[model samples]
Target: MKSLQKLATIALAIILMGSCTAQEEATTLKDALKDYFYIGTALNVPQVAGQDPQAIEIVKTHFNSVVAENCMKMMYLQPEEGVFFWDEADAFIEFAEANDMQVIGHTLVWHSQAPRWMFVDENGDQVSRERLIERMKTHVQTVVERYKGRVHGWDVVNETILDDGSWRQSPWVRIIGPEFVQMAFEFAHEIDPDVELYYNDYSVSRPEKRDGIYNMVKDLIDNGVKIDAVGLQGHLSMDFPTVEMKEEALQKLASLGVKVMVTEMDITVLPWPSRRHSAEVSLNYEISDEYNPYPNGLSEESYTALMDKYVDFFEMFMRNKDIISRVTVWGVDDNQSWRNNWPIRGRTDYPLLFDRDYQPKSAVTRIIELANAKKQ
Candidate 1:
């Protein structure tokens, strides 16, 4: 029976691989990592709605998991209070289902991209703690209930902890208190008891913030919250957060007895800016040739440097795949990545496994080769 079950997993993988007539079946990221963890990519509205043929091809062929990059966020889904937009969110889930892929609902709660109405009343007064909690419950219930069993997990809360291990003091904390995190998780769980819940943050690999997350999650687990995973937002760069830093983080988060996922994984190969370490949505800079050095193109030396960096990270991920349920590149390819406009408005960044042309980078091939070789 065990042998038969292994055969079944392979057979299903092949069917998902589909047919390649003119050539032998092409090697894919998902297939290579099937025995390790789910390989996933993020989708914007274009790909979710079947508009980007190139990204759709990559999603269907190389990825078995998908996350909505923006469509499922609070501002996009509920730009105004009591009125929700379901078109893009629904289309996102539908796309995943149609492709036989697992869906990770990007986020159910976040301080960034949240509607301004959520924290205040019509009179422009900050809502009371009780009032805000009710609002949160309603929002989570409506959204989580809509996609209950379809999604593998949700980043139930995002970026609430600071790098110094202090709470960020976002309006949620000011009004709803630290328990806001717990409430959001509870609300999501109440709607779908089966869905996995995650606490996601960036800069969590730093020991100071890592200890902060550990203590916060330990309290929640001790209180019997349904926390299933901790998302290490691996928004990496060519140099920041050494491999040892991440490896230690992986083991520390796993100590909590919950699975770890390298959510929102991307490695920007551009020059670092002032706010070099944070993925703050508000971080922006005026572009100059200094930061935007690669606007024309990446040099051979720079490209090889980026490739080596990716290989190092992927190797670490593979080593710790037992506790890592998924490793998702933040975008489909270079052209679609948010890094291009992030930190600086007009800098070019090569961050993902695929290039601007939708061709898989040599780094991707190397990672796939390493994965296959390990399994063999």
Candidate 2:
């Protein structure tokens, strides 16, 4: 009887040891880049609400930081004047906090997606410049104060500078002039001095746009404003903005003595609407078969090309890890990526590290291998 008991104990011990080994073998993206910088992903409404178990699991396993894909946007957060919706945004913050992930508040101010009421009056005319400035002040202070110390960083301003090294004629720019960008940053700092402030924009690798952004940030710093970082929205493609261009942009931004972050990164494996390099391109076209190239699924050739592009970009990022603070993929998976519906609607695009089935692509493995090599 004593011998039987001893054998059972031995079997239990072996099983426990095997379980421990399996757990340790679960190397994640966050773990791979732990010593270098944060690996992050943007979470949509469904994932933040716990409706998408597979996406949530992927985020938990691979990422150490979280940004809301839409919940925290000004339009969604404040649909009407003087009325702010906090349900989804609150849940998003809670989810990130529960997961022990750093939270990034995406876009306190942007030209697009903002409510029309903000720029127009009851008679459908643009509000007075004074009125607009006050409204912006209230909006920035209210949102930043609500989250206070919970959010570690904020994309305080977004896409204000055009690609031609001039300010975009956005409503904010038109009403409050170029100083609106400065005002937004100042308000955020006044509300929470600890929160890191960032100016985020797409197509930042283009020379003209890079110069414009650098000058804007440099001017703000010269004026005694606290600009912590510049977020280069890495909505890249397979062909444009070569590695050298991206490196030059990063080097210039870092030279200004401000931290850099690769925010909203995704490599689109699809055709472009036009020759423009901007990801904000939103040309609408009637549904057609030609536009949907990968209707069935991505061929092995296309898959390999996509993986190569991702690995190449990751290599560049690792090379400049000193200036780049965090690297965030725009969505959790290809199925949820904004590329599927933007510029051309209903077109399937594989632009993230995970497939629609929640499986990590070949690029994820290659990226992990690259990061591990650096450690060694």
Please provide TM-scores, in order, for all candidate models, with all chains considered together: 0.92, 0.92
Residue 99 miss distance in model 2 (angstroms): 0.4
Model 2 residue 251 CA deviation in Å? 1.0
- Model 2, 1-376: lDDT tens per residue? 9999999999999999978865564267998888778889999998887899999999999999999998888899899999999999999999999999999998799988788799998899989999998888898999999999999999999899988989999899888899999999999999999999999998889999999999999999999999999999889888888888988998899999999998999988787767676766445756567768897789999999989988898899998988989999999999989888887889998999999999999999898888877875
Model 2 residue runs over 4 Å out of place are: 1-26
lDDT of each: 0.88, 0.90
Using lDDT, give the best candidate's number: 2
Q: List the residue pairs that clash in candidate 2.
A: none
User: Deviation in angstroms for 48 in model 1?
Assistant: 1.5
lDDT of 1: 0.88
lDDT of 1 by residue, 164-268 (tens): 999989999999889999999999998899999999998778999999999999999999999999989889987788888988988898999999888888998
Worst 10 residues of 1 by lDDT: 17-26
